[model samples]
Target: MLATVARPSPESDPFSPPGIALEASALMGLRHLARRGTGATTRGRSGLPGGLVTRRRGRGTEPDDVRPWAEGDDVRHIDRNATARTGTLHVRTHHEERDRAVVLLADFRPSMLFGTRRALRSVAAAEALVLLGWRIAGDGGRVGLCVAGAEPLALPPRGAGRGMAALCQGLARGHAGALAAPLHDDPPLSPILEQARALLPAGGHLVLASALDSPGDDFSERLAALAERISVSLILVSDAFERIAPPGLYPYATPDGRRGTARISGRARPAPEDRLAACARLGLACLRLDTETGPEGFAPLMERLDAVL
Candidate 1:
């Protein structure tokens, strides 16, 4: 059984730093995006008797209704009895067989607290979560989340209701809390992945957003196992500086007033590209979001995400 964190009390601190926040306007924007058809139909191989659940209409066990056939209606779905009786083409439509679980694994470790150009990495992650959550909810699917920080938080999958609202609020609180809380040993991605696997129903979709800079040795094995069971995608959140550090001596100090100076040799970093390649090698779809560019820069990427989910 996975240990679950109790939902935190709503923060009353108006002074909370401008980090990741869940705003109504942003969520509304996502609603508009969904209306514009950003939410992709779900598709994946789950090895189950039935494949992935999708919104697309298809031949299902349960009979829905018979209606006049349209030009694009599948010929196989034509009701022979109705067609003969009415001397007009008629077709059978079925309700969606099932609702798919959409789980978001958001990383809120201390490393996500830093950003140079746009917003903190944590903020970007939160925005991405909100976008995905709303997109799935708008598509009439369930949404859930697993937040990894000092203390991990999990909300089981639910439809667009109070559950989704709680999830949005929880995401904002989790990211904000991470900034003010003391540092601790960050939880490993493997265990979180395990919990997510347990939470998601078969054929469900999982979206993981993180810097993914320090996934432990067991990460690959666990990811591969999870991928075999369900659809898995990765959103690699990174700062421009991480990919190409400026050439100069930089000084930094901790909150405790400990100061240090470091030299940046302008060496090119391959970690970002390497991470993308690794996802490809594992057969996991990956999206890279740079903090400097923000999410708006990835219109094509968002479309790809829609098609995959």
Candidate 2:
């Protein structure tokens, strides 16, 4: 069974920087994609079988709660009798909103260790979790996470706080010990992806985070199959620095503790661009993360995605 992992409280997170400013910037860039005069139900394209939930508007009700009106306000829900007795205008405020279930898949293979950045891609994946989860959680949504590698770690869907914590713990672990060993030879990612599919409460969203480092074509096909089942967003985290490293030139240590450098031309892998293009072809919303750029560049990326999702 998938479980939630413990994480430091918001108070203890040293990097718990205020998200409001950053979120506001992302929202600003996303405003163009916003629909104003249209009815609440008409927001964004509908997805999947259930269609979508619509919002009802009234006088005093704000999409994001601005303020209360004194008098002469739209009395869509006013009590005429009460107004006569109280001699004051009264209005009800309603928030027109909907929630999206977001699934986060993190790839924690050993290859993530090869990064020019000190924190490594493994650590960088955790940071991406916070950024992506922040937006979804801000809108009162749920999040599920899956860690892929020789051993896959799964954290079933949970509300914001617990889900984020669980993801962090999953990323911190090197690999699954016992429960994941049995599936090593032919580990089918289908079960986990199906779990993700089940968690998306009709009309929800999905986000898969990975380095695309695993062997074979299983993960790719699994992801394509997932998109057909549900709306998915892919955040592909990769280390560009690794592509430039010369082969055989890596430092190698012998079993006896002796260390030497070998000239290996095949050590380096193909460019991340190819993998990213493949994801785009799969019709998944792709977010390319790099250590050099950090999460600050997420503003524009989310802007483009806001329209699609």
Candidate 3:
């Protein structure tokens, strides 16, 4: 069943930025694409179909039985040996495997509430999760999510149903809450990653979306370990301001209403590319997305994900 939560009106929250508002139209477009099953185009190194293929034994590769050819059956599965021996058209069928689980880890911490281009990092992360959830559900797979903020929310993996809708709603709500009440304490991502790892089954898919600027020192090691068991994708969501702050003093206010001016330099501290390289060194498929683009920005990343999955 899908989870339920109280949704606040858009006008109720004055502090919340407009860009952070969830874009229903964009999400619907992605949902339509997912329902059409148009994103599964990658092949794995083992010669198996990539991006949410069944793992359990089924009518996949290994032949289980030879039966009389039926209309609408795939012609590629024709059993030449059986057909020639019986002097009749026959086709081999294998046991179909169960759907795989897809887990999305969204970092909706206070830091993600800031963005300069299109939407806040938190909103971008939520949008990305929505697209992935729809794609996975449309592909006959299950979707799960873990939203990390001051108060983390976890939804177990489930097939296309109320559970998926609940998960999407939970993300949207969580993003708004995070923006309204930014957390002062830094939330550790390692624990969330560990929890998600424990929840996912072997051969499942995992996607982690966050700035990943200061994931604990052992974050890379833990992520590498998890990738060994399942297909993992890391999305680095950022803002244009975070990438390059103009050379001037900019006034900033905290959640507590404390206002201050900070000086900006020609270069952004802790270059985002450095994190990208770090993820690369760990042999991870990482995609860098900024606020300027919408959820449609995920198309290219999904292509790269096809190769990794």
Q: Which ten residues in a row have the lowest lDDT in candidate 3?
A: 1-10
lDDT of 3: 0.68
Misplaced by over 4 Å in model 1 are 1-30, 33-59, 62-96, 255-257, 266-269, 298-300
Model 2 agreement with the true structure over 128-198: per-residue lDDT tens digits: 66555544443445766676665566666666555655655565453323222222233445566676677
Of 2 and 3, the candidate ahead on TM-score is 3
Cα RMSD (angstroms) for every candidate in the order listed = 7.5, 11.6, 7.3
Q: What digit string (tens of lDDT, one per residue) describes model 3 on residues 100-215?
A: 68789998776676666777777777777777677566555678888888668888888775656778677766766676663465466889997887778766788898987556
Q: After superposition, how far is residue 118 of candidate 1 from its true place, in Å?
A: 1.5
lDDT of 2: 0.52
Cα error, candidate 2, residue 76 (Å): 17
Instruction: Assess each prediction's global lDDT (C-alpha) against the native.
Output: 0.68, 0.52, 0.68
The global Cα lDDT (0 to 1) of model 1 is 0.68
Between prediction 1 and prediction 2, the one with superior TM-score is: 1
* Pairs of residues at least 3 apart in sequence or in different chains that clash in candidate 1: 40-306, 42-309
Decoy 2 TM-score against native = 0.58
Put down candidate 1 lDDT per residue, 166-237, tens digits, no spaces.
787677667656755654555578988888777888668888988885667789898988888888989888
Q: In model 1, how large is the Cα lDDT of residue 10?
A: 61
